[model samples]
Target: MTLVEGSGCFVVTDEGVRLMDLVGGIAVNALGHCHPEVVEAASAQMRRLLHTSNLYYTTPQVELAEALVASAFPGRVFWCNSGAEANEAAIKVARKWGRLHRRGAFTVVTLEGAFHGRTLATLAATGNAHYSDPFRPLPEGFRQVPRGDLAAVERALVDPDRPGVAVLAEPIQGESGVNPLGTEYLVGLRELCDRHRALLILDEVQTGMGRTGTMWAHQAAGIVPDLMTAAKGLGGGLPLGAVLVSKTADCLEPGDHGSTFGGNPVACAAGLAAISVITRDRLFNRAAIAGDQLKEGILGFRAMGLPVADVRGSGLLLGIGLSEPWARELAGVALQEGLLINPIGAATIRLAPPLVISDDEIELALEGLRSSLVRVMRDKGL
Candidate 1:
């Protein structure tokens, strides 16, 4: 796991295994590893200013906040260190708003297969028992409903005799596999949230920053959420995240929440650089184009009698599915062949390559994946 060196689209491990980095640091390195612009921006910011906290004003922090709002959402932002913190902030704001306005109704509803974060509050919000079971007696006021089921959410809103404050979900569930809620479903959630006077929070941690062919995935629905979270690709392989609030959901007051290193100038500089590159190079368009090409290529594997049962995702965030539970073994085979992919659950191979990946790189990954599939299928007699 100790990658001491890396260049664009590749990483050198401690054991000196240079692999094509298709994971993109779990979608954090959207601009790719060791991008020259990010490196220079981070270096320059470090030399100028390191940590000033939020007690004072710094250029990079303000600039990044402005860039995020101007490009994607128009609202105030709260800086954080990771997706967990960003979601935590959003949850806090929702709870505060509910307590203040909804007769002390403080429940927040989330989707069943979504992965919000690992923090205690987020863990409670996450519907999977495997992640929340070990840590019992978690923070309360959290509920789960089936993904894309509006009726289920409506019932969850009032079943327990409490008004719901927010309904939080990821446009595409990344950790549970690249499961995408279509535009119709997403727009329905927005309408339902508004109908019941509840807030809609989109956890864009894994799908934002052009990962889903747009500045934000919610835009695909042509609807805006009251609150949204972003991380992963924002930091350009560093640690930075943001919670963007619309005017309607700007409920957090001063001293309500804070982070010592949340708005670090160096991290903000790297984020700014990453956003600049993604925009300037039109990587958003590239991700859409390359994602379609890659998905089509993977789907083409069926002709050769391979085990690619399905392909699902938006833009570069793709999941190559298998009919049986052999994804983990296929991933091991891929690693041996010098390509890296993350196995999700029982049958999904998650692929979130950098937006800068070329057609040749796409071909390289497909070749390795096809070979791995062939080997695994033959060995398992599938």
Candidate 2:
């Protein structure tokens, strides 16, 4: 779809149809499309400075790094352009740390159904074979275990001859479907990583910046990871990604990694603005409350005798499970009805609207979803 213009929670297409953007650009537009604060900050920065070699530090870059460290993670932050680059840097961190700290150990343990990035190494790190298969001979040193299976993680980490360096997994696998790991598993994963001396890498690429009702999803579990990657909504709408390392695991040395447009001052400025709104408005807490409302509404679809089988995920990041493989059809119908959502796998329709969306907007989205499902069912003669 070609979007010509956008505002908070809505996008206008070239065809003149306005859509309530429940997808949030796949969970990237946290404050909604073209949020005024974010746009103003980026515009102001673009006036003074836009891009410069990383040879010199930019104020926005340093300010964001400081803010992140102060509230989120403690170690240094590596700037990047997208979630892919963030995860790529994360994998590199694991590889470097493994070689330096472990007995040349470099394997990264990943969870099944995880989607890290499209980059070759990150693709290999991604557990879904379909994404990695197109590019054959994927980089080695990555292993996959079932999501939330601590015993499997333990087994994957126990190879002494080729020790594991890190375990990278999403707290909730967003792309495959909204499959959430239990809080128990998340805490257990941290403990397992500690026991194995392996870094725990939480890919908050889709869940960070108040998406999961927390600044960082790992925070909700009350367990700090050795390293983490965040992007998606970090820049409000701009392309900005960050790899946050803990103080003890801040191992990336100078000359080890760099990105040409990694921390563009303009993007960092937008990030600062987004962070400001997120913090000042307490969007994290707001997301938790709003998410509960949304999930409750979706679950009500079943009571209405819709095809909805389940409602899953935390915060605004949610997926509605259809009893049949009609999510793609329902999404198409919803788009025609001016509601935008994403279908993952065969049966789940994912909704990742802006964190600042109103309750009325949630009701609107729910209505659109219900209408779409009803229409699709009728057409299918179900």
Candidate 3:
């Protein structure tokens, strides 16, 4: 049935109905589907130069790197294929950084309920057991600390047996139902990492690139991570990711790491276009305003006794927790009603509408949720 055909915020299927894309490819399509500027840039770059090995530098890659560095990152950028690759690169940097000081400082401290990527190392870095259980006995040295527990983190860092190399965490646990770490925790983490000489690695793959109303989610916490894994919205639907490193964390010397198609001209062009669209168009501000509207809309629905438990998040990345575990069923109802939304887990429904969604589109999704909830309640005899 082609589940979805044609693009933009709305898509059509073999069923011949248009559906709004509220998930944005799980927060990848920053400009939405088939954006004219991105599409044209990609097409032009592809027709001119598709890809080149990293042995030789490409203009688009260098330009994109320069842009990222000039921005808040102001450091080296390592090109990669996706979020997993970005995290992989970051882990390597952290490990290498640790090895610089001494041996066995390879342990990485992660938080519970954090999702980094699907790769083996990233999977281990991810705190969720379900994802890691399938591939048990993962790479060693990844330790999970209860999120927001400063004492656990302190012990991990100060362990005399082996020094902790880095602290890997997501500013907000997106895949684990959008659990945001407290800003106080982040502040303390920065201070702790500074004291222990451990790098603070933030997996911003899901929360970066203006998805959280700020250019990066950590900006809200007033801390800068040593390395930031960026993806989801970087390529504007193209397969692209980056490991943004601070000057001190730039440990990957030339030839230390490289990717064949990491900085393909087409993907780089798409990334440049995406960043241009995000910065020039002020999508961050737009997301902030839209997110506030959506949050208020969700809170209003909850106040109406819609069974919505807690509505929280900044910007377009909002998570709605239902009083009952009806999210799985409600997702189907929303899809049937021509609105595409995704449930993060059994009880939490995550809504990440495109940064380009209009006021009317937001209203439509709110209404769709209202209708879907009614159908769910009716079926459950609530």
Candidate 4:
């Protein structure tokens, strides 16, 4: 579909079709599209100062970094242009920290089914054959283990043949169908990282910015990570990413890394505004309540026996599992029903709506989804 404009929880296509945006720009539109505050902030900054190389500093950049540090753990921030760049920066920090503290232990242990980023280094870290296969000779020094398996993680971390310097994972694996790693598993990862003297890196690109009922999903897990990469919603619809470095894991020196358009003034201003709105309005709490409402509504479909097998994930990041592999067809039907949703593979439908979505909008989405599901079931002869 050719989307021309967006406002709040809906978008308008060039063909004049208005669809409820449940995908939320793939979890990047935390405050929804064209938020007044964000728009004004970006516009004001663009008029004032658009760009200044890292040699100079801008207020929006400094303010946004301060906001992130204040909201999350105490950390230094390295700005980037996308989630991949943020993950790349985290990887570099892990390697540098390993060289300095872990006797050159450079291997990063990542969970299977995790989607870090698309860059060569982050792709290597993701360890997904589907994404890394065609690009052979991927950057090495990364190991993959089963998701939620602490024992396997320990084995990989303690491998005498290859010392692991970091354990990188998403608090909720969004691309692989919104599979939450669970609080126990997150705590386990932190403990393992501490015991192995390895850094814990949480990729919050899709779950950060109040998408998972908290500013950071790992916050609910009650374990502090050594480094955290945030991006999807950080720019408030603009391209901005960051690697927040804990004081203990801060090892990058001058000339270690840099990005030309990483922290543009306009993008940082938009980020600052987006965060301000989320904090002042307490959208994180709203995300929790609204998520419960949405999940329960979807579960109602399962109760009615309409192909929904399960609803996975927490807060706004949810996945609808189908009893049959009809996710693609269901999504197409949903579009026809005037809703926008994301299908993960063949069996799961991902829903990541804006935090600002209302109760009424939630009901509208449920109505459209229910109709779509019934239509798909009937068409498939189920």
Candidate 5:
């Protein structure tokens, strides 16, 4: 659909159809569309300055960095333009940190089903053949192991031939259908990384900024990653990303890396406003409550003999598993029914609604989803 404008939890199409935007720009619109605070912040920053490159320090950039570090841990922040760039920064930090600290060990061990980014190095870190096959000759020094398998991770990290200098992972895998690695597994990962002396890198690109019911998803496990990357909803729909560097893992020098539009003044301004709203209003808790509402609602469909089999992930980042392989069809029907949802492959529907979504909007989403499900069932003669 050709979206023309957006307000709150809904978007208007060129045809004037007001559809509930459960997709939330794929989880980028933290405060919903056209949030006045974000608009004013960006406008105010534009009036003062727009782009100064990274050569000079802008107030928004410095303040945003300070805010991110304050929220995550006691460390520094590296600004970037997207999730891929953030992950790329983390990868560079890992490699440099390995050289300086891990006897030149360079391999970064990632879990299977993880989605880091599309850059060559991050793609190599992702270890997805479909995404990496066409882009052959991917960067080396990356290994993949079974998700949630601490034994496998320990084995890879201690591989004497080419030891892993870091362990990179998502607290909950999003693009691969919202597979949560569990608190026990995450805590185990931290322990393994510590025992092996490997930097723990948590890719919070899709799960950060209150998307997963917390400031950062790793907080749920009570583990602090040596390096953390954040994006998606960070800029309140503006293009911005950041890498939070821990005190021990802060290894990048002045000339090690840079980005032209990494921390644009306007983007940082919007991000600061977004973060302020999330923190002051405690939208993370709202996300948790809304997520529970949505999850319970979908699961309730199962009792009525609908296709819903399970709900995965936490907070707004949810994956609805269907008992049948009709996710694509269901998504199409859902769109026609005035709901916007993402379908992962054939059996899972992804929901990443705005944190500001109201209970009534959620009910609308559930109603639309139910209608779509019934239509799909009827059409398929189920």
Candidate 6:
């Protein structure tokens, strides 16, 4: 019998062993697993109303929409069920915006290492070929380019034949080991997109909702995208997503898109509660401070002879680069030491603990990492 009841940063396994959750349910548990407020909101809403189709409106749904639009990147909000749906809606808006305004340019440009989502359209938009190669004949008009190379993006934008190309990007490539796009490069891409009449779409599904210190990651660049997608933390573990569209791309007509369970009342209730907690409690600042602490701690470990190459990120969304491909082994060691963390790739370990994580938790996680690194290095004969 597997035990399945747990909450907050500590989880109890079936055997009754308690474990610290540093991954925060892969960044979805923003308020931590089954936060009391969120759980109460969801339960209360579920009892009142669960589903109310597009024909009707509910308070929770309306409140969530208002909250999302209020924090949006100068755009209107469209709700959905997950990150993939949000990306899909963003793609539709980009395509439609291009078709109507640019007279039939259908190409949407994305950067390599970007992880948009897993839906057919989003999987096509994702720049990673490993995810795309499995299913060939992907959706058309998604142009893949190297990330942070403004000159390459400029070339693609200037190609007159690709008239309707829209540049879709993640400010920081979270899934590809947390590679941050340079501020200069992002600004340059914005200018290029504007100059070439291409719509700029930011895939903020992982980086938005205060994950990167700011309310939104692209705020660092001071550029507003024509479209943006958010999901992971927006609902705070309630399974909700949204696509924000700029006024210019408000071309979505009735019946253009619809979802039966996109904005469920229960999910919206959870979203509203989560947003209230995040904004009122000031978790964004907490994430920034924790991020700085984590970075400094990791850097200190390097100074102590751990062969750490780089530690780059903003807020709580951080990635540690190793001198060798030992992230998996290191993660294994950390797990054995009673920490919950994940490897982004062969050489990178991604850290996205909850925004409400305590200072002690952060230090303990870092200590676990330091010890794991020492053990893995010795085991690997490094």
Q: What is the lDDT of residue 371 in candidate 2?
A: 90
Error of 2 at 38 (Å): 0.5
lDDT of 3 by residue, 1-382 (tens): 3655746678787878888888888988877888888999999998898877888878888988887766556788899889999999999999888888646489999998889988899899885778889887789878888987999999999888866899999888899998888699988988999999899998888887788888788898999888988888888789999999998888788988888888778998998898888889989899999999888888887767788898867798889989998898999999888888889788999888789888998899889988899889888887
Candidate 4 per-residue lDDT over residues 160-266, each given as its tens digit:
99989999999999999989999999999999999989999999999999989988999999989999999989999999999999999999987899999999899
- Candidate 2 residue lDDT tens string, 1-382: 7989999999999999999999989999889988999999999999999999888899999998887776686799999999999999988888888878887789999998889999998898886778878797888899888877799899889976656889998988898898888689999999999998999999999988888888888788898988889898887789999999887677898899998999899999999999889988999898998899988888888887889888889998998888999988988999999998899889998999999889898889888888998899899996
Candidates sorted on lDDT, descending: 4, 5, 1, 2, 3, 6
lDDT of each: 0.90, 0.89, 0.86, 0.95, 0.93, 0.84
Q: List the lowest-lDDT window of 10 residues for candidate 5.
A: 337-346
Could you report the Cα RMSD, in angstroms, for every candidate shown? 1.1, 1.0, 1.3, 0.7, 0.7, 1.6
Listed in order, each prediction's TM-score against the native is 0.98, 0.98, 0.97, 0.99, 0.99, 0.96
lDDT (Cα, tens digit) per residue for candidate 6, span 1-382: 2436667776677777676777776778777788999999999998999898977878998888788777765567888999889989988888887778888888888888888888778889885678888887788888778877888887777678775468988998889988889688889888998898888888888888787887788887888888888889888788899888888778898789989988888888999999888888878888899899989999998788996899977888888998889888888888777777779889988888888888888888788888989998889786
lDDT of 2 at 226: 86
Model 6: lDDT equals 0.84
**Worst lDDT 10-window in candidate 2:** 65-74
State residue 139's C-alpha deviation in candidate 3, in Å: 0.7
